[model samples]
Target: MKFKIEFSGHENIRSNHQKTIEITKESHLTPQGDCIVGVNANHACADLPQDLKEKLKNPDSKITFSIDVGEHNFTIEGKGHPDLILTHDEDIVIRKSDFVCPRTLAVKCDKASDLLPREMVSMLQDPKTKGTFTITVD
Candidate 1:
């Protein structure tokens, strides 16, 4: 199954957090949101399609999360965990940790905000930049 989110960048995007990458439905950003790569998101945790969310709750499921901004593309490979509840209303978070939370889409992620290409991060800092965030489960 697959899900996609459309979101816009923000001037405050720092993309410096070491463990997680976040996309939020909120339209504004703060410097403290170092893990946030995209804002004004079209989908949050709770808005995901029910079948996709179901796959995301299975520990055996393989999940691929990707982001494309302008000409740059990046991807993270991870797994779903039974612990995932997928109920957060404002954010979708991908984490390198196994800890599951309402906002977490995948755990044991291979990449996070700090590991994103600096060039892509630069593009994501522009408020006018549009990005696509995609999640695929297999």
Candidate 2:
């Protein structure tokens, strides 16, 4: 099967360009039915608000986002933050056990910051920032 995932947010918090990800079933899904999708840390985490960052640190934190696949639309709730960590040599590693996969979907951001870009931060403060990523499995 083939999977296509798209991530989006409020106009201000949205990525500068269309962000889509593709994964092959044979590579991303394990025999136990566990599916792993790599997220762009720079795009997803670097600009989060301080409170959200704190929330993500908890092992039980959950973030809700919307998703659209062909004619079906729904929401995906993620548990905790991804385990990706950036190293000095620009390599990424899984620092946590949340994701039990052998590979990652994307590179980790250099670091996560409490202060988001002005536009995104304003939207979060005003509570206008909301977005979702669609996952297509075929």
Best by TM-score: 1
Compared with the true structure, what per-residue lDDT tens digits does model 2 show for residues 1-138?
122333322222221211222122121222232121222222323333445444544445444433342343443333344443212221122211244232322322221212123343234222232323432111
Candidate 1 contains a number of clashing pairs equal to 0
**Model 1 ranges off by over 4 Å:** none
True-structure lDDT of candidate 2: 0.29
The true-versus-predicted C-alpha distance at residue 13 of model 1, in Å, is 0.3
Using Cα atoms with residue i matched to residue i, what is each candidate's TM-score against the true structure?
Answer: 0.98, 0.30
Instruction: Count clashing residue pairs per candidate.
Output: 0, 1
Q: Per-residue alpha-carbon lDDT of model 1 for 15-92, expressed as tens digits?
A: 999999999999989999999999999999999888998898899998998899988999999999988989999999
| Model 1, C-alpha of 24: deviation from truth (Å) | 0.1
Per-candidate local distance difference test: 0.93, 0.29
